[model samples]
Target: MLTKRIIPCLDIKDGRTVKGVNFVDLRDAGDPVALASAYAEQGADELVFLDISATQEQRKTFASLVKEIARHINIPFTVGGGISSVEDVAPLLEAGADKVSINSSAVRNPQLINELSKAFGAQCIVLAIDARKIDNAWIVHTHGGKNSTDKKLFTWAKEGQDRGAGEILFTSMDHDGTKNGFAIDPLSKLHALLTIPVIASGGAGSMGHFADVFALAKADAALAASVFHFGEIQIPELKTFLKNHNIPVRL
Candidate 1:
């Protein structure tokens, strides 16, 4: 089996790394460049750097910041926020992002996924879906989880796959920052429905949570923010724990 990945997400707002609960009540985390370098040295399998406010604020991701972070981290890096078209992706790739993630923009123009996948190849197009359970349905959200969309999580994820997205980065707004656990049921469903890798995000509070996401949900990767940012969990130790549990991870 392919080794599962552990990714640390750096949510950027106002040029600083931040963390929030359910996509609001944001708090400062640290300098992203410093954090990226640290995670690289400590053995993070990959890094996700998102300019969290770029979409809501009506701007593109900080390509300069992406460049700086990429310079520091040797691991695979995915950059996102405000990416909309093939035009938006080129600079980020040139700036050093191994892959580009798109959320609100992709939802707005599903064709953007095909265009990006065609232009950049499916290997580098990550479709990020942020959803919240509303009235028992997992409804997709946009503009950094502020607006509700008619798009349901399962259908939209499958549509994204058909559009040639390389991976699905699903963030459950209901579970985000709760530290309870990952949204296992939906994740498992996504795992079974999609052939591409699924990167599970939000609600990672402990090592056991990571184990459960992989063991139960069959998620390809597990991503977290606050736990890793606040030193609540360290990547090397987490990898050791997963290795002991027979969850394939790179230590």
Candidate 2:
């Protein structure tokens, strides 16, 4: 059995970590470099750093900050936001990102996925889909969840895999920061349809939520921000809780 992964996400705005509800009313969480070191010390399986406003603001990801954070942690680090081409990915990787996540750019130019996979190997490419349930169908959103796209969630996931993406990081805009739990139905469906790993993002409130996402949704990993950033949940304690509940986690 593959051990489930618990990842903590750092949503960056103005070079500082921030958190928000349903992608609105952002509040400061902490310094990104400090938080990254703490999460790594807590045994987090991975760390995701997203320059949440980069795409909307039309700026590149903060590679210098990424490098500063990467130096403090030993775990795999993934960076996203405002990444549009292979050129955008190079600096982040050179700054120590183990994976590059592309969202709006992928929807705009699907070929970029194939190009990135071929250039850096699929293992380093992660397709991030931010979707919200509209009329009972999940619709992809971009530009930091400020814009919506006509593309449906599952169809896009399939296209991403065919284009050689190594993993899918699906964030339910509706469930983001809700603490209601993951969108299990969609997660399970995506997991069943894709051979690559599916990371369930948003709506994580407790350890039970983490276990449910792993056992019920069969998500390869669960990523959360506010809960981890605010100290509402600690990775070490959450891992212990999952282990007790029969969820295989690296403790």
Residue-wise C-alpha lDDT for candidate 2, range 174-199, written one tens digit per residue: 99879999999999999899999999
Estimate the TM-score of every prediction. 0.91, 0.91
Error of 2 at 71 (Å): 1.7
CA lDDT scores, all candidates in order: 0.88, 0.87
Ten-residue segment with the worst summed lDDT in candidate 1?
20-29
Q: Model 1: which residue pairs collide?
A: none
For residue 199, what is the lDDT in candidate 1?
Answer: 99
In model 2, the runs with Cα more than 4 Å from the true position are 20-29, 53-61
Candidate 1, backbone clash total: 0
Task: Give each model's clash number.
Answer: 0, 0
Question: Over 4 Å off in model 1, which ranges?
Answer: 19-29, 53-61
lDDT of 2 at 218: 96
